[model samples]
Target: MKAFSHERAPDGKNEWLTPPEIVQALGPFDLDPCAPINRPWPTAARHFTAEDNGLIKPWEGRVWLNPPYGQETIKWMRRMREHRNGIALIFARTETRTFHECVWGVADAILWIRGRLTFFNVDGTRPKSTGGAPSVLIAYGRENAGRLHLCGLQGRITPA
Candidate 1:
């Protein structure tokens, strides 16, 4: 079960981290837009699947997430909050107060993707599409999002 672990080393070839992946690796995506998954509609590791929905349920342990890039982001963020154990990778849109409250306000950490990502479709197939927007990885509670070290990626929001 090879999930989309964002820990690719820089060994050249297809191992180079794209901007969206980079942002996910970063944390507290506070300065960019969310990147859409690359490809058309259903790639193996890009888009959401029935398997994902099943796995990300209201479990009382660590979790994974790659939410869809739409108005429903807030819904997904809320779901993560309910779980208490979550690591959600989603697009970063500063304008969304709902997103900010659920993800940025409550989340423990945030990663800003440096580039775009082409999300996959539902059938685990790559879509013929690309997104130029940046993205973010929002971690719910205090835990690792994808088994990656949070080091400098740790972030917090202080009231002004």
Candidate 2:
């Protein structure tokens, strides 16, 4: 159970990379507006770092977002809702306000990943521990919803 908790560094960082398999399954995206340089997967043709302030940039084109998982996640979720053309990987905390506002009713489709996924570290290595919480992949547009339908991932697909 300890492993399930996304332990933060002393600096309040819960930055974990999405598994490459999940990336490959759902994408072929255009931009990873929130990717750190050390991320394991090549999320898109263009990516932005923390310094780039992806929230300020136009999230144009097919996007793949695995935004920081902290208090700032709400900002990223707001950005995604604005972009309206991408896939987002996030914790399936249905009771959270972000889920209710940003994901539950707004997303065109949602795939509740069956179990807790093991996220990678900045070094591209799998973390020794698996997350305690389950995950979700939200499709922001109809095209992405279609992609989710055909992505071959195990989950329940709910369309809005």
- The predictions' CA RMSDs to the true structure, in order, are 11.3, 2.6
Query: Which whole-number lDDT from 0 to 100 does residue 12 have in model 1?
Result: 15
The weakest ten consecutive residues by lDDT in model 2 span 3-12
| Model 1 local distance difference test score | 0.46
RMSD of 1: 11.3
Best by the TM-score measure? 2
Q: Rate the local accuracy (lDDT) of all candidates.
A: 0.46, 0.83
Tens-digit lDDT track of model 2 for 12-98: 356678888898998899999988756655889889988888889877799999888767888899889988999999888787778
Per-residue CA lDDT of model 1 for 64-156, tens digit only, reads 555443555566667767776656665556667657578655766666644556643323344444443455666565545443344444333
